[model samples]
Target: MIRLAGLAVAPWLLWPLLGAFIGLMPAPAGADDTASSPATLLPAPVAPVPPLLDRQQVDAAIGRLDGIVDAAMAKTAIPGVAVAVVYKDEILYAKGFGLREVGQPEPVDMDTVFLLASVSKPITSTILARLVGDKLFDWDDPVRGHDPSFALSDPYVTENATFADLLSHRSGLNTGAGDLLEDLGFDRETILSRLDQQPLDPFRSTYHYSNYGYTAGAVAAAKAAGEPFEDIAERVLFEPLGMSRSSYRHTDYLGHANRARIHVRVGDPAERRWEARYDRMPDAQAPAGGASGSISDLARYLRLQLRDGSFEGEPIVDAGALATTHLPHIAGRLPADPTERAGFYGLGWNVGYDDLGRVTLGHSGAFVLGTSTAILLLPGEELGIAAITNGEPIGVPEAIGSTFMDIAQHGEQTVDWLSFIGGFFAHEFAVDPAGPDYAEPPASAEPPRADDAYAGTYDNSYYGPLVVETEGGALSMKLGPADAPKRFPLTPYDGDVFTFEPIGENAAPLSAAQFRTGDDGGIASVTLEFYDRTGLGTFTRN
Candidate 1:
């Protein structure tokens, strides 16, 4: 639960940005490309978005979020979208807009189903929580003890880490050393064997996002409960929460005829929209993120969490467990002003914070062209928000998320749509011609040499193994098990500063990377902050 203040574009991050590139920023990318907007396949917007809550104040709040949503879409490259808000047991807001399938021209509505991606974690966590309550397994169970099939390159973490450790991301498993990405064609057993090569960091310190880890834990839960992951989910979550329209298994949606299409954020309006899929998980990883449902159905589930883990007079997770689950874990900090940090991870949700630092437990997901989200407040208020889209939008999930809280917690109105987005890209990500980044100093622009200084295996649980190389007078971004390492021609921008230009087609262009020199005056860990992704990480010499 990295705080939203750090990640969401705000007034402060927008000012200088607009001043820098409002007039000269690159023309929106071609559709289907993240760097640009869509080129074709534009779908018609849905009929007027239907309202869920009628409160003027609530509408004002929803409007603020909607504005951000519109802008966020422009940045993220999303197509159609559906959103729902719930308070207590009452539906507050529900709306639909954009196309459902880019190739096809259908609109989206409440019943449209999209891949849940990581948003599936909380629901999976809720089910496992019920299993824990049922004495099926203990949170303390060593993950491997419950399912010996679980293995990683790091033997110590493999044997010592428990279910709790896995949930907390302290298992130290670097990204996907097990070759899950490459083995998209393999079955469960085939992929799990690659674990021996993936190293884990020392366990129990910080939160590391790992799809493989969560999927593995989910598989273990399924094994422990003696049921298929989907079955267990149906019995424990979907049914009780009345997410009847939801399914763990994939399906082509026929309901809620008006659904948003998936679009590549190629920066244009004309582009093809299509469905995308997730090929990883469940050698047994159902527990991390593997479920989908309508926005309304997810809202019901959120209402349950908002009501202290109960909904419609039924307790999904007891209040005591709810408290424990919602409590913060992992010093989980997103980059932002320390004073404004506003969220943390609690069990499975990415909880948000406000000016008061209160908890707003929520979660969001992004897989291919689609993004899913569920955000709710559980303290003094019981506001909940959920959205599902077939195609990914530029940061729409977060935009919608923050606006929900601002309205729910503070009664703020939605900002002006076009203006906000106009301001947003202008501020947060724009590269300034005269800014400090361009003015910084680096040790030398002379091509970095391969002085053993660039040799080491850097491991990040979320990013996996990266082999740094000094090849042909340049650095290499050898993302092991992720297709191939793309080479970069490093150009120093400032002090130990550099930018990475990917080689070959579809290679990222002109992204920033910064380095730290070791005591001996050679580069140590080079921490990179790239555009359009989660936290940037280190690539140690391997």
Candidate 2:
């Protein structure tokens, strides 16, 4: 009975949100790792991404939010959103918006579950902190102390990497370095084995956001606790905190009936049209971003943070240990226009100051299957906000959080954030309606060779084998390790270039597949440009 309304609008945020903060940029055509003829490429103008928020509009949005959300949802056509606000040790608001599914009449309610994505990190950190309170392992203890097999390319880092370093994303690896393996169905152990082969960024010299680093920390925590990561999280975090409705496993989330379906806009920005897909992040990545829960459940989490590691007069974790998670372990800058005046990367939380110079802590997460989430905690103000949407790249979560903060700090004012967001995004989409048009090849060009010529097995060190085959004069691909094989149906665009649409229950956006010819006119290699604008290159013919 607590359904509200919200608009899922924002053209700039349309990029895939699976990785760390570094992979948010939009992709361009002819930007793949392989060499191709310029004449065969299709280039289009890239739209300028709007800044995070407009102060005036944010103030306005908070006032007329209901009507604004209704109008914005009407325009964007997004299916559903859920929001929760915790102020001064109490939940000030908790509600859902729109339907759980497009054709289903069951409206989303406060209990509707949605994937937390990377927002699961703070919880993970909190659990680890509890384990530390039990003297399982110290934060600065070397990772190898828990798991001797833990190794990295840099010998010093491999020997000295601590639990704190991994949680804070300062383990010296590049952003999302091993994500390719995990996405392709590789297990955590398998991906971790190949991690030493990746290049290191510099020993604590830079903050390179990494999902793998957090997973590594989780593995270490599990090793020290003598149990699985999910089990430890449940015992130390969920159960202790009384979050009965939350779970770290996707399988568990699926068993719940009130979960919100994931969705994304397919064609143009002007259209609010969306396509729903089930969450496909493997259980192996759960430690990094696989938890699911409802607004009511998240409110409990915010409450726990506000109380400094206590829930219902019981100490779930030592306040001192919990405070360590908020301490700035590494300083860094955010992607905002002004470069995030004062920002630091804490364990699983982004610690920074708002425009009002008040301390704020938060993190965000998303997946290719269509989910975006953000959680913010203002310990100084005893306020927190958690926003989850079944759609992506809309900036809805941040908008909601900032709107709530605006209300908390400056007192309530006349604002319609949703309508203002919708109108601004609608106009921006109208100005540059085409999305990723620059990433496609020319459609009129003929195939460089027969379909049979390109049919064969291609392989890479990290991504494994990709089998391209022709069936009934059409091309299709099956890739990844043997455990999880994904198939893609291909359509020829320009010469030797084909676009593949993910085929299966959990579908992804169309990706470009370009086959390169050798000097002898035989297919030499193929390069695939994925949704995140990163390319998997030189899948040499086998």
TM for every model, in the order presented, reads 0.63, 0.78
- The candidate maximizing lDDT is 2
Which candidate has the top score in TM-score?
Answer: 2
lDDT of model 1 at position 147: 88
Q: How far out, in Å, is residue 510 in model 2?
A: 5.9
**192-278, model 2: which lDDT tens digit per residue?**
877887788877757888888888888988999999998988888888777887988888888889988888677754654777745
Assess candidate 1 and give its lDDT. Answer: 0.53
Lowest summed lDDT across 10 adjacent residues in model 2 is found at 26-35
Task: Write candidate 1's Cα lDDT for 1-542 as tens digits.
Answer: 22232444332222211211110000011111111111111232123222233456565776665665666566544667777877656777777666666556666666666656567777777777777767777666777877888877667777766665665455666543332333223344444555555555656655566656666777787889887888888888788888877766643233334333334444344654344432222223434544666777777777776676677887776554444444444434444665444234545655433323333455556543344443444343456677666654334554565556556444653443234433453354345566334334455555544435555567654445666656776655555345544345555565555677532211234666666677878776677665213233665543
Determine which window of 10 residues in candidate 1 has minimal summed lDDT: 20-29
Total clashes in model 1, counting residue pairs 3 or more apart in sequence or in different chains? 70
In model 1, the runs with Cα more than 4 Å from the true position are: 1-56, 59-78, 103-105, 176-184, 251-261, 267-286, 334-343, 372-378, 413-542
